[model samples]
Target: MSGILSEDALDTLFRHARTHNAWQDKPVSDETLYKLYDLMKWGPTSANCSAARIVFVKSKEAKEKLKPALSAGNLEKTMAAPVTAIIGYDVEFYERLPELFPHAPEAKTWFNWSKEWAEQTAFRNGSLQGGYFILAARALGLDCGPMSGFDMKKVDEAFFAGTTVKVNFLCNLGYGNPDGLFGRSPRLPFADVCQIV
Candidate 1:
């Protein structure tokens, strides 16, 4: 509770974080990856179901498996990044709800083996954790490249053959090459984007 980022640190986390498309050849150490997970795991989840599953692609063989699945335009960037994470969601995430939501017995029933309910909870909570992953990566001084332009079936076949984890998205991460970035894109204005309700 005593640990908190300085104002400058907080600003840098939000302001400097960008959708990186290019990366330096430097490797992302396992230590840093572990720390990134540690930071992100603290973010809240519904019933603490914590459904997100991450597969880090760094080996040449793993990257090769993913290459044919990517859009032609995205292949280069996806291959170039030091690590590409296959973010996934476990369909049986509620099995752990007993520990996560210890006070509530009925919570586990919400995300049980029923496909419809399980799919909804897994996708919703898993996507929330994905956002947490990006924030944690930025806070740890890593760049992020998030994309939805890949073949989901190929990805699932390659990474989740015998598992219930379904692919959510792909994220390429490492140190970014700022010189290679296009101009910063504009965001929707707050006036047009939010409601005071």
Candidate 2:
């Protein structure tokens, strides 16, 4: 259970997985969303700060609320999606550290030193959780369309007003349509992107 995974399992999570732009007309149920969170929450974060906050925009009304914030090019695909998740980071995430990182209660005060430090931790850890979300969704038979083509400030106003949360990125989730998939692009060779010490 602790070794490298089978090729098929790896393919499901990476090699063949894609960022989808088109989706089939299907709905993602609340139960699936709950399960996705339960699975992805286990992904590690620094001191287990666990800062990611997500809002699933599924209803027509909710989608409309998100419309004005999306870039023109992202509007169509996102609107057609079964669910568009607004991934955010809570600037006040450290407030929960006393409860979340209780083994060391002093953890709550670590990020309170400065606004910049807390924000940096929140963005970094929240982004890691977002990556976990995409893989978790793919592993659970769902396709993903993670994107950043939106107005972050507007999205924050529309979805997170009166809160310390700020939008980091958006993801559309559902069954992807093969008819809309684009050709795979090349990736950097190992030598070009990595090196052995």
Candidate 3:
């Protein structure tokens, strides 16, 4: 927990990772999905709000259910991937603070301050958890194709109707087909994006 990871490990988690559009005919096991969540759940969230919820669409029926919500560019790849994870934020996440935050039962009442603020907190922390999900998958030798090109309302209606959750984004997961990769895009250097006092 205190030491730096080797260069290979860093590459696996970040540098070498690509947003894959094509995948091998490989299946991600249910056990592996369980392990993925178990690893990602430890990422710190404000007040341990732990608002992110995921729905893994794998079977034909589930994929069909999610189909109409996908944008044109995402449709083919999403339908072909081994798994498509629907990451969502729970607006009413504060309800579970008593257990997830423990020692501060009063933390749950903080949501009473404002509905808007609670929603903002949920979305922010849930987005953090979603980042953790991608890194966790990459660490496990899986490729990720995270995308925002979907009809949010359609996704929420298809997967989270009657629930407190709402869809945030989608990520297709599998063993990537390197033949589909394009040239890596350039990133802004730290000097251009950072500040020092």
Candidate 4:
């Protein structure tokens, strides 16, 4: 079994990490983005569905395309970020089950039979992958700002039109500007939010 991660690593991934609203002038390189995905892709998904798709919005042209879809509150920060990742879920992701879940060659048939089930599985696993993306970014020493304040329909039309992918959420990536941070928010205690049963 693997040993527990050290305190420094835990703090880097969780305790000391903050959701950044503003970014420093530093840019996130394309190589870093590729490495981020390389790490996050290993996160598990049900039946190995691996349904999450991502569009890294880095160029001015791409950011402009995303601007109209953003809520007023998210517009400025997103545009200022070095990168904004549009996480998407593919409705037809199950078709790749034969390749992703090779142990169960017929796994694709399960979701193919029911549109509702397929959609559910895609969203569920896609969201899980999005979580993994966040942790992976943090591990790579990048700050993240995840938001759902954009218009989903507009995003889909702008970025995923004519494709089976649908927007899940957006996350901005960069080195954070500490001056832009809000006060640390409180969280529920384990006793209040969880049980040992």
Best-performing candidate as measured by lDDT: 4
Residue pairs in collision within model 2: none
lDDT tens digits, residues 120-174, model 4? Answer: 9999999999999999999999999999999999999999999999999999999
Q: In each prediction, how many residue pairs overlap at the backbone (N, C-alpha, C within less than 3 A)? A: 0, 0, 0, 0
Candidate 3 on 16-106: residue-level lDDT in tens?
Answer: 8999999999999999899899999999999999999999999999999999999999999999999999999999999899888888979
The true-versus-predicted C-alpha distance at residue 152 of model 4, in Å, is 0.2
Clash pairs (backbone) in predicted model 3: none
In angstroms, how far off is 84's CA in candidate 2? 0.4
State the RMSD for candidate 2.
0.8
Query: TM-score for every candidate vs. truth?
Result: 0.94, 0.98, 0.98, 0.99
Compared with the true structure, what per-residue lDDT tens digits does model 1 show for residues 53-167? Answer: 9999999999999998899878999999999999999988888888888999889887675889888988999999999999999888899998999999999998999998999
TM-score for predicted model 1 compared with the true structure: 0.94
Off by over 4 Å in 3: none
Query: What's the lDDT for candidate 1?
Result: 0.91
Put down candidate 2 lDDT per residue, 4-71, tens digits, no spaces.
98999999999999989999998999999999999999999999999999999999999999999999
